[model samples]
Structure formats: C-alpha cells, structure tokens
Target: MRAIFPIVTVVIVAIIGVIVFHLLSFPMPWMLGSLFGVLLTQLIWKIPMKWPVMMRNIGLLIVGTAIGQLFTFNILIAMKDTLLFMFMLNIVLSLFCLAMAYLLKKWARIPFATAIIASIPGGLSQLVVFAEEQKDIDVTVVTFFHVIRVLFVVGLIPIIVSLTGEVPGAPAQGSSNLLHNLSLILLGLLLLPIGKKLRLPVPHFLTPVLIGLLLSLFKVDVDPMDGHLLHIAQLCIGAYIGLLLHPKSLRLPVRVLIGGISSAILLLVLTFFIAEGMVFFFDLDFATSYLSTAPGGMDQMGLIATALQADATHVTIFQLFRMLFIYVIILPILKWKILK
Candidate 1:
C-alpha cells in the first residue's frame, strides 16, 4: 500500500505526457511523452516515484512478442541472404565502438576498462552485469553512458524516421481478441523462468521473441498486438527510463557527463554513415538499414521499426545478431584480451 501511491503518481504523470504528445502529433508519443514527463517531473519537483523492474520486464515481453510475430516463413527465407551481412556488420560496428571507447577513455580520463565497457553499445543490463564482475570498472559510469545513449537514440531515431517519409507498408493492426492476447501473455510468463534458467543476455525480451519466431515457423496464428497494447508497453518502459535519468541519481564530474553525451552523439553520427553505406550496398531503405545498425537498445529500435513499418523482421534479426555477437564473441574476447 505504501509503495503503490508513488507508482500511481508516476503513472498519472506519464499519462498526461502521453496525452500532450499525442495532441502534438509527435512520433512515439506514448514513449517520448511519458519518458520526458516523468523525467522532468522528477528533475524539477523531485517527486517520490517508483517503477519496479517487473514493470520493465512486462514491457519487454510485450515488445518481444510483437516482434516475434514478424518472422513469417517468407521473411525468414529472405533474411538468410542477409545473415552474413549482419554478422559482418556487427564486427565492423563493434570495432568502431571500440575506437570510440579509446577516445572516451582519453577525453574523460577514466580507466580503459571502464571506458570500453561504457562505450560498448550493448544492452545496459548485460553491460552493467559485466562491469560489476570486473575490477576497477565504474559501474555507475557504464550505466550512465548507456542510459544517456539510449535516451538520445530512443528520442531522436523515431523523429528522424518520421521526418524521412512514410513507412512503405501499412502499420500493423494488432488483434482485438482479448482472449488470444491474454493467452499469449500467459505463455510469455511461463517462459520467463526458462529464459532466466538459460541465462540469455536479455531473457525477458529474447525469450518471448524466440517463442514468437517458433510459433511463426510453425504457422501459428498469433496476431501482432495493435497500438493500444504497444502504448502500454511504451508507457511502462518510457516511465522507467525517465526515472533512470533522474538528475539526482547521477553524481559525476562535468567532464564525464560531457564525454558521455558527446560520445553518444558521435556514435549516432557514425552509425548514420554506416547506415548510408548499407543503403548504397544493399537493396534496403535508409530507415530499415539505419534502425538495424543503430547501436541502441534492441527493444527501442524494434519499437521504432514497427512504428515506421520498416522491415521489422530484418531489424529484429540484425539487432538480435548484434546482441548475440556482443555476448558470445566480443565480450569474451574483451575479457580475455583486455582484462587478462
């Protein structure tokens, strides 16, 4: 009962943000609005707010389930041709991120391990876990960098994609059947433990995605959720992100903050050039290629892809491949080469 009030307060504030952004015709109004709303309220008023990890997990599950349904038989077949490209792209992108890590190391005067871990464009949770295991690495700096970068990427990418032009196909119209979605939600819940047991990098999100993809391959009829559900998911995620950026929570030197922000911007610029290269080399549009390669959170990019009606199937594959690459190949090499 005591904790519930704060939760309800933030939710109400987040809803107001959604309403305001929706009125302004903003792209990703629910997410952007709720995110900024909660962030500003906390920063300005210092309101007591609390969003549970479970809320965020629920949001990821919804997003993962939606993205999973995108993997149709034809789409999977088409993705085969790009699998090699995706692998190569991850290597190149990781290399560039490492280079930027060196720059961040010098600019911020932080240890190389801390800089590299912070600069690596991997999942925040996973990166933080990695940082926690290492000696002399500032987990706070790593968390701050990723959070700021994700905030920038999430806030900017959707607007840029919206400004570029309309997405080619029709927007996804989610199923209206309550029972079907409820069953899917139940299944996602059941898989949670399995995901944790497997120790997948991002178990909540990836587990549902894998399940959805398997269902797709087997020709199961799970309707992709519509805007209403997506809105709720966005609200859940956005509000939490807003709280993460609560100004008081971050206590770092001005130089480090500047380095973190500038490095994040630099990464976005670098990603844009790579995205352009993707456009030139492959028969892909800028939006799909950009979102696919952008070193942001997979869930956030997935959300933007769905909103833009870009090749979400392609985006999911590329993002997933990058994530796995980071965990399996890149992190191991870093641990052995750098930490050793």
Candidate 2:
C-alpha cells in the first residue's frame, strides 16, 4: 500500500505534465512535462516518490538504440575531422572549471574542494561518487548545483532551438515487422550484460548504442523505434530524474544558491562561445555545435539533439568523447592535485 500510493501519485503527475506540455505544443513534451510535473509535486507536497532503476535502464536501452540508428561511415569520418577541436575544447572547459571554482571559493565562502567538485562538468553521478571519497567536500551541494544546472540547460535550450525556426520532421514510422523488432530487442538485451562486464559507463545505454552503430555501418536494416515507444522512454527518464530532487538537499544559504546559479550561467555563456567556434571552424550547423559543446549528461543532451533534429551521430560522438576525456584524463589530474 505504501508503494502503491506514491506510484499512483507520480503517475497522475506525469499524466498531467504530458497533457499540459502537449497543449502548449512543446518539443519533447513527455520528457519536459514529466520532469516539471514531478519536480513541482515533490517540492510542493513534499511527497516521497520513487522511480525504479530497472525502468530507467529500459529507457536508456531504447534511447541508445534510437541514437545508434543515426550512425554511418560518413558520420564516423566527419567525427574524425573534429578530434583536434574536441581536445582543445576539453582544455578550455577545464580551465573554465578552475576559474569557476575560484570564484565560488572567494565569493560563496565554500571550501576549495567542494567548489572544485561542484564546478567540474562531468556526469552528476560521477561527481557525486567522487565527492563521497573526499573528506571535506559536500555531496549535497554538488548534487544541488548539478541538478539546477541540468534543469536550466534542458529547459532553456529547447526554447532557444524553437526560436531558431527549425522544426524537426515528424518521427519516423518504423517497420511493421514484429520479428525484426523482436530481434533488435533481443540484441539489445544480450548486449546489456556484456556492456556491464566490459565496465562501460551507462552500460545499458552505451552497449546497445555500440551494437546499433555497428549494425548501421554495415547497412543492417533495423527499423527505427515508433514515436510512442520513444515517448514512454522519455517519460521514464524524466520521472527518474525528477524523483532525485530532494528539496531538503538544498539546505545551503541563499548566497550559495546565487553563486551556483551565477556559475552555471557563466558556464552556459562559455559553452555558447565554444559552440560558435566549432561552427566557424568546422562549418557545422548551429544546433549540432551547441549540443556537442553543452555540458549536460550524455543521455539528456543526446535526447535534446534528437528532439531538435540535429545530427545525433555528431552530437553523440562529441558528448561521448568529452565524457571519456573527463573520466580518463581530467579526473585523475584533479584527484592528484586536489586530494594530495
């Protein structure tokens, strides 16, 4: 009974969010709607909500497969051309993180370790886990900063895209072959454990994505997912993220919130400049460049690219590259310098 009430309430909130977003004709209505709906419900009612991890993993699998359908030999070749630019951008973003940390330490009176951890543009889960190992850093503050930054970017970027007058085409109507769809599903399921064994980040999603990309390059005729299935996936992702918002986690002073917001805005501005550089140098489209440079998580940014009808292949390549670089190169340096 306890679980049932929270589940029912969350469902009701999700339904209302979907309806409202649909009425407003918003892009990626299911995702944004459910996110906002559950966030508001949790904040106002203080109700305890839970989103099953299994549901979120299923959503990741679907999204990863959909993105993989965009991959091709040509896309791979194009990504190779931008490798230098991606590496340069990583350096620039790292410097920016250090600058932001300095400002937070000076203005907000936060500890240097906490400021630096909060300022890093890595994945939220990665940052939180890293914070757990540090003695003086505040995990709640880092989480609060990341959650707010994600909300800001996700909400604002879609509106910016809409104003640019590039309406995405209708979702592809996939093949009606039940057998083919089942085969694809089976392939994704089989890859999940393999991805885990390989220790891939976000294995449920990345594993399917890697498999789908291989199939796409080989000209395999896997059908695209139906629009309804995609929406369900979005709903699961949005609800899961929404349930993570614990208002009590944000117990910092007003000045700390202000500082975090300011730092987030500064990061967005820097992202805009970097994206413009990519467009100017690489001759890429605006949406793809912006999405590639955005500091949001892999899945969230990928979804935004899909929503905006940008080159999902390019966006995915850049985002995955940056994520891997942060985890591999930048994080180790930070651990050595800051922890020692």
Candidate 3:
C-alpha cells in the first residue's frame, strides 16, 4: 500500500498536468506541480518511499537526457563571444566567492575548498564527485552549501518573473517535436555503460557535446525538436529536486547561512548588471544576457528562456559556454590549485 501511494501520486500529478494543459491553454505550471509534489510528499509522508525516489530519478534521467540533446553546432560560431564572457564571468564569480570564502573561513571556520565548492553554481553531482576526489574536504559541507544555492536560485527565479509581470510559461503545455527524442535518450543511456567501459571523463549526457561537435564535422545535425519532451524532462528534474527537501537537514549556523545567501544574491544582481552591459557592448539581446547571468544551472536558465519565450539561442550559447568554462577551466583550476 505504501509503495502504491507514490505511483498513485505520480498518476495524479500527470492527470493534473493534463488538466492544467487544457485549462491554461497548454502551460504546465511546473512550479506549482513541483511545490505540490514536494509539499504532498512532506505532509503525506515526511519520509519518502522508495517508489517516489525511483520515479523522481526516472524523471531526472529522462529530462536531463532530453535537455542535453539540445546542443548543436551553431554553438561554435557563438563560442568566441561565450569564451570572452566566461573569462569575465569567471573573474566576477570567483572574486565574489573569494571574498565570501574568506568570510566563511573566518566565521564558519570551514576550509577554503569547502567554501569554494559551496559557492559553485549548480552542478551538484559533479561537486559531490569532486568532493569525493578531494582528500581533505568534507563532502557533507560542500553538499550542504550547494543545496542552499539551488534552493535560493529556484526560489528567487519565480519571484523575479512575478516582478517582471510575467508568470512565465507556468502552465505550459504544447506539441513537443519528439520524433527522434527517444533515440537521443537511448543514445544518452547507452553512453553511460560505454563510458563506464571507456572511462570517459564526465557523465553520459556530456558526450552529446562531443557527439554534436563530431556531427558538425559531417554537417549532420541532430538537435532533437520535441519541446513537449523537454517539458516532461524539466518536470522530472524538478520533481527530483522537490523530493530533496528536508528542513531538518538544513541545520547550518545562522552566520554562514546568512553570508552564503547574501553572497549569492549579491553576485546574482551584480552579474545581472555586468551581463547586461556586456550584452549591450556585444550587441546581444536583453533576454539572453539576463539568462546568462541568472545564477544556477544551464538547463534552468534555458527553462527561464522557454517560460519567458525569450531569445533561447543566445541564452543557450552563453550558458553552455560558461558551463564549458566551468568544466574545463574552473573545475580543473580549483581542483588543482585549491581543492588539491
């Protein structure tokens, strides 16, 4: 009976999503669905059943794969601008962290690497993986801080949208061109085992970047077109996040918590102004610049673009570029110089 409850919950949420689709004229209200799921899980059963976790993971894998497939060759042309933005964004984000880290180390008395890990944008899984790799840092501390950052970003974004007088595509639902989406998903899954065999450096979804670049070599494009699939994917990821809530686990000292929140929000606002200036200087669009500096994951930023119906291409370009910077430059530098 307990096992069945989560299954029942998912069915109910899906039904609600469908109903929302029709009533809202196709907007899925992801934030509402997510909050409802989280609140329901907490209230109905503060201790989540295995079924809920399983369902949530399925949603994560599916949505994450689909979102990853959106990468393509045009990213190359935009690479120059993105790289420049990375250099600039990196300096700002790092400095913001550096100052915050000093404060955290002084008051919180945590190590520099732990503080830096906490300051990282999204990429929680990678942070965990790296935490494991680092000999000295407390994985628990890094995880705690990263979790705080995610909560802050997710919470703040909706508020920002509300202030802008746009509800986002909250109840978004529409035809997602998913003809080849399954194939891409399958391919992403396939890469995991193969990568395990081949010892690839990153997660399976990352291979699509290499795959995209290689496909570009042959002038072959495979950016999947199913927007509906993307929505479902986002739903899954969002659900997984919702399941992660536990007010009990957030027992941080008030000073550190306040400092972390202040640093992130301050950096977010400052980066927004800087990004806007950079966009104007580079003749880029407003929506694109706004998203690129929006503080958090690439997929989340892209979702913002979709919800607002903004310039997705530019957002994707810079977000991906910035992420690549994190992967290749920032991660390695921090790992080598600081974490190591």
Candidate 4:
C-alpha cells in the first residue's frame, strides 16, 4: 500500500510520455518519453518517486540480450579495426575531463577533489562513492553535476540523431521457438550473479551482454526479442533514470547550480567535437560516433544505440573502454594526487 502512489505516478507519467513522443515522432519514443515525463513530473510536483532497482536490472537484462544479437563476426572485425582509435579517444577524453576539473576548481570555487570527481565523464556512481570517502568534498554537488551531465546527454543525443535522419533499423526477427528465447534469457540471468561476484561495473548489463556475445561466437541460435519487449525495456530504463533526478537532493546555491550547468554544457560540447573527429578520421557513422563519445552511462548509451540501429557492439565496446580507462587508470592517479 505504501508503494502504490509512486508506482501509479510513474505509470501515469510514462503513459503521457509515450503518447507525447509518439505524437511528435521522436526517436526512441518510449525511452525519451518516459524519461522526460517523469523528469517533468518530479520537477514540478517534487514528488517522491522510486522505481525498484530490481526492475531496472530486469530491463538491463533484456536490453543487454538484445544488443548481444549484434555481436556477429563482421562487427567484431570492425571493432578490431578501430581498437587503436578507441584507445586514443579514451586517453583524450580523460585529459579533457582533467582540464574541465581544473576549470571548475578555478571558476566555480569547487574543491579540487569534488571538481575532479564531478568532471570525470564516466563512473558516476563510483565517483560519488569515492567522494564520500574524501575530505571537504561535497557529495551532493558531485552527484548534482553527474546527474545533470547524464540527463543532458541522454536528453539531447537522441534528438540530434533524429535530426540527422538516423532511422531505426528493422526490428529483429529471432528464432520463432519460444523455448530458445527463454533459454537465452535464462542464460543471461544466470550470468548476473557471476558478474556481481566478480565486481564488474554494471553487472546486470555487462554480464548478460558478455554471455550473449559468447553464445553468438559459438553460433548458438539465440532469438532476438520482439519490438514490444524492447519498448518495455526502454520504459523501465527511462523511468529508473527519471527517478534518479531528485531536485530536493540538490541543495546548492544558485551560483553553484549555474556552475554545474556550465560544466555539463562544456562536457557535452567536448563530446560533440570528439564525435565529429571520429566521423572524419575513423569514417564511422554519425550515430555510432556520437554514441561512442556521449558522456552518459554505458547502459544508457547502449540503449540509445540499439534504438537508433547504430552499431551497438561498437558503442558498447567504446563505452566499456572509457569506463575501464577511467576506473582502472585515471581514478587511481586522481586519488594519489588529489586525495593524498
């Protein structure tokens, strides 16, 4: 009974979002609709909306499996061809983050640690957790900036893709056998625990994707999920993201809010330049390049790539590379230099 109102609110907002986006012919209507719908509702009413974590994990599972269907040999070959470029991009993005952090420290009057953590392009949750362990770092401000960055990227990238006329690909037609689809789904589910046990980032998404990729490599005939299932997955993910934007938690001065918004805009602009570079140098498509450079969560970017019929595998790989570079390399250096 206690959870009923929030659940109802989410459903109502999501329905409204779907209708609005559909009417407007928006790209990734279900996702963008639910995201903005709940976002607007939360902003206006200041409602306490909560979507269960398990529901989001379930959505990730579905989306991961769907993306995995694209892990064919040809895609793998293409990814290999671009491996060096991806590595360079990751390094360049890391430097861009550090430069932004310095600007924040200078202009925003943010403490060094907070600015550094907030400036980081990926690892929002991890950065927040790390900030909690540091002295004189405002976790609220860090979270505010991180949340705003993700919201800005997610909200805008799809619209840009739509404007560029990146049409959604034909819906996947997997094996017609129900049992086969069930088995693939179950396999993905079973891998979740292993991913968690291994302490992988975004285990719910990464585990299933890796499992699906392995199955694909072995020539296992996994069924692609229907379009309706994909929409449901998008709805779940969008609602979860919407619920994350707690305006009440952002107890900052107006100046600070302005600074945070500026930082987010700067990051978005840098992402756009990098993406364009990829297009010119690597000759990747607009959707793929934009998604690869977009500074949103890996799972969210992958979802957008899947929706836009971009190379999901390429997006996933690039995102994973950035995450790994940030967490494994940049984070340690930041800790040593700033925290110590």
* Candidate lDDT (C-alpha), each: 0.83, 0.80, 0.60, 0.82
* Candidates' RMSD to native: 1.8, 2.0, 4.6, 1.9
Model 3 regions more than 4 Å off: 1-28, 35-72, 158-162, 165-178, 192-204, 208-224, 311-313, 331-340
Q: Give the winner by lDDT.
A: 1
Candidate 3 lDDT score relative to the true structure: 0.60
Model 2 agreement with the true structure over 112-229: per-residue lDDT tens digits:
8899889888787778898888888888889888887887777677776677665455555556454565476568888788888998877877787888878977788777765666
lDDT per residue (tens digit) for residues 1-340 in model 3: 9768865665556446445644664333664355445545654565543225445444444544544444456665656655766677766776777777787888787787787777766466667787888788877677767665666665565456446543424234344445565676666666666655765334443454445455557776455436666556556555555545456545767766676667667767876687668667876555556676766666566565655555554565566666666777877888778766
Clashing pairs in 4: none
Candidate order (lDDT): 1, 4, 2, 3
TM-scores for all predictions: 0.94, 0.93, 0.75, 0.94
lDDT of 1 at 251: 74
lDDT of 4 by residue, 44-67 (tens): 896767788887787888788888
TM-score of 2: 0.93
> Which pairs, if any, clash in model 1?
174-226
